[model samples]
Target: MSPLLWAVGSLLLLSLVYVAPKGATYILIDDNLDTELAPPFVLLQEGKALDYRSTTVVERLMNGLPRNALRPGLQPLVGLMALLDPLPAYLLHELLVRLAGLVGMYLLLRRYGLPGARHATLCAALALAWAVLPTYTAYGASVLGQPWVVLALLNLRLGPGRWSDWLVLVGFALWSSLVLTGVFVLAAAGMVLVWDASRHRRVAWRPVLGVGLLALGYLLVEYPLVYSLLIERQFVSHRVEFDYAQLAPGGVGAGLIGAVRYFGLGQYHAGLFLRAAPLLAAGLALAYVPAGPARRRLVQWLAFSLSILGVVALFCGFYPQLIGVAQRLLPLLRAFNLSRIHFLTPLLWFGVLVLSLRRLPAGWLPLGLVGLQLLIGLSMNPEWTLNVRRLLGRLPATEPTYAAYVAPELFARVQQAIRARTGQRPAQYRVACLGFPPAVASLNGFYTLDAYQNNYPLSYKRQFRPLMAAELAKSPALQTYFDAWGNRCYLFSAELGKNFRVAAFPAQVVHEWAFDAQAFRRLGGRYVLSAARLQHPERSGLQLLESRTAPGAYWRIWVYQVRN
Candidate 1:
């Protein structure tokens, strides 16, 4: 079969089955839109631009704006794609990721496979399996950053003619997700260089040079915007702490597996996949096969590096989350912004397919592997881990609705009143919430704020404001007061609620709603809801309106609307 033919087949398979999971982003990334605007705290401070000194999301978001000092040179490209298509850039990112994965497989095979059309066909077949590997496509397609990171890895060694191409791929890599992925690219290049030198008795400066130039191009394009954000946006002050030396396992897998058993995901992917799994065993059999050509050996090295990533990903799986807790503070590693750690499979196996292509038995190996995957798919968990949720769901739990919102809403409502009383639009507004979503809602534009380090809750809890917000605002030679009180509004979710870390208010409002979780369980487990505005229509906008808008029974919202 022709390589082109295989490429077509891979594309067809990807289109049919390997797409983003509809609800996968629900836990953190999807529900949260503030990440697109900037950090919540920065928006609170009403800084439309970012400061150069900081490397946080707030900084990147603000810097991406035209007026920001630390400009995102490539963020506009993402934003542009979003604008042209009338789709969320998040969704658009999924599109890019799928394509990048396909292309990456092609390049992987091109570089390592035997000289013939078989290389392309094998790459296609391998890509088909990988793209459909529930873990890789569904998990990864939902993410914007990981796919770009995969592509950047592939283009890091493109031929000499396209400086422009290098700039785009590298730029997208640095621009998307956490900027630390750029560092990942650099490390990959170094590892690639070392492998080449040792394996062939000669260092391949070209690959190394390509990667370096790409990195430089990334920084060159990104600096102006991000640097500005560093100066302009307070949220830019936040930093992710990563510690490579302190690697440990976490029970990410268990937490999820527990969820699965509790929620039925246990019966979905893993359980089903494991039941008739010989095909999986056979496909995997190829991964462990013996040696191939020198180039194939290079593929092996890349695969090894990816395996190390897989091991690192176990941080999200085995240590029961304490390890992941500590991971948030770690430097470069934190920026990988991994939600589904399993997404690494495609990137890793792309190399495996490339290296193992030569040794693949021609006759029935491909069909056999596909059969193994299909047979195994039955036992694996198709849904996600839901044990804790299911266990808790089985329990009847309730807390009083009174003041749950006001306890936090008082300060917030007062701030809203104050903003209304003053009739000033503070230029930009930010509201500190569990995440930045509501803060972005306070006004029309975006804000700079912090997330509670992805899904892992802040160890600080009530003090999370001081812990989460203040740190997000702190830059060199800064005061604690400056960091803590720097925001305009704070939103507290009464359903899953907290007062956060700060206490200040001139305006606030609290509204509550009640929904029977039991009703949903009884009615096919569906929770129905609607919202009403407590405050009059005249009170909408600024901070005052949040108190006006109240949710159904299952939730309550407490808002602190600050003066501009």
Candidate 2:
């Protein structure tokens, strides 16, 4: 098939496999549902995306979260989200990210990996697989657009590069996050430059210049992060207490297992396309290739890829010890995760896929490999899986569609009920969620005392700790989770443990609730929108205001008022 035919075919497949399902029954849960989806939608809806003021507060979340705590709005994807409604914006973001990957990888492969028209179909196939790798849309093109950065750098390294190469560098830096992927990308680019310089015994000024441009772009785009971390010294972030030691594997065997799992399958947060098949394909290609430049290049890439995996594995394996020592000395190291370099490995593995495909002779073999990858990508995608299950009438009652997840009508009823009961609007009082994510409240325009925040004031964390202290005492694991990584500073239940998704079907009950109502009220928490019913609410100083249920709503929220 020709390039145009391949493109059209891929787009159709993307629509059938991804876009249609997403439009129909978008699954909203976990990280995407709680942390990422709401912020962009809320910010855009409330007309706060353009507000660059540091003092600006997003009143809907964290009892007035600083605007800088959310993602910066100086990107194309953010602009796109700003233009559309929540669901449409989300779908568009997903589509754009996928398309960007497909185009970028195809162009990169055409320029460097496979240089002829005969290889165009294979390039498209590989790129399509890369495009559909189930990376989180909230992250924009951080993982997918990596090939664009490489292409831009390679263009500069080869010669006086085109303006498009410079455009790619700047555009990628803007689209991606410095904290998430940009910093590591620059590091990788710098490594390449150093390696080239060492081999050639000379410096390549163009690629160096390209790298500098990309870094500068990141600085410009990530001004919010820069300002918050460096310029603003008023509030220390809760991330300062992040305890990697508690999370990391303990013994050598367990560490090795952790390393091996990560090296092979990758963490879900960082584009979790399993690398086993690709690694096997690469190994097979390396073994079979003739003794020549092709073999030499294959060997070099294999060694390079293996080295990266080895370093990442070892770092992950001994992360507890390494981070312990580093944090003890610096203390600043606790806030920032150095393990995120693992983010770049997915891109490297895909690159390996391209190389492995090129090494093989033209046949069904390469096509079969591409087909297998695409299948894996689709199967691994949570959204796709949920949609497929829903389509087959097998979706669990716990799993929610986009409509059911938000249930704007249901929340409106709750809002009205609260106002009728208290004679005050949602804005006049703060709320926190129990047995469910605060995202539901936040998304429905309620000012929440508790929220899922990647970065928030440490002072707020300290204040919030009191409310959950008794519950935390019962569960040492919950204590560590909240104190060390208090991202989800919700009202944790000792009975519930870490299971927050308390839907109506399970009929969850918290037997012995030890909530500090005084602390909750002091923090401006007027109501607790709990999915789990408390057996002894009076003991916790909570008056059951209303038990709300709506037709199509996932949660049977039992609204509890903190008695004065």
lDDT tens readout by residue for model 2, 545-564: 88888777778889999887
TM-score per prediction, in order, is: 0.51, 0.96
lDDT of 1 by residue, 1-564 (tens): 665466556545534322223211211122223233233223233343333343333321222222322234245434433344212333344445546555554554555443466445555655444333333221222222333444444454444435544554555544442243454545655776788679889765556666666666666555644444444533332323332223322244565554333222212211112312322332444465655675466556655654564454443344335435556555434434442333333344334434443445555765565445433332231211221232244311222121221222333443455367556442334333431233233222323232322221122223233322322333321222222222222222343233232122222332432222232222221111112222321232223334332221212334433222
TM-score of 2: 0.96
Instruction: Work out candidate 1's RMSD over C-alphas.
Output: 12.5
Q: How many clashes (backbone N, Cα, C below 3 Å) per candidate?
A: 99, 0
Q: Which residue pairs show collisions in model 2? A: none
Model 1 off-target regions past 4 Å? 1-34, 37-73, 81-88, 119-121, 128-178, 224-236, 240-345, 353-358, 368-436, 439-564
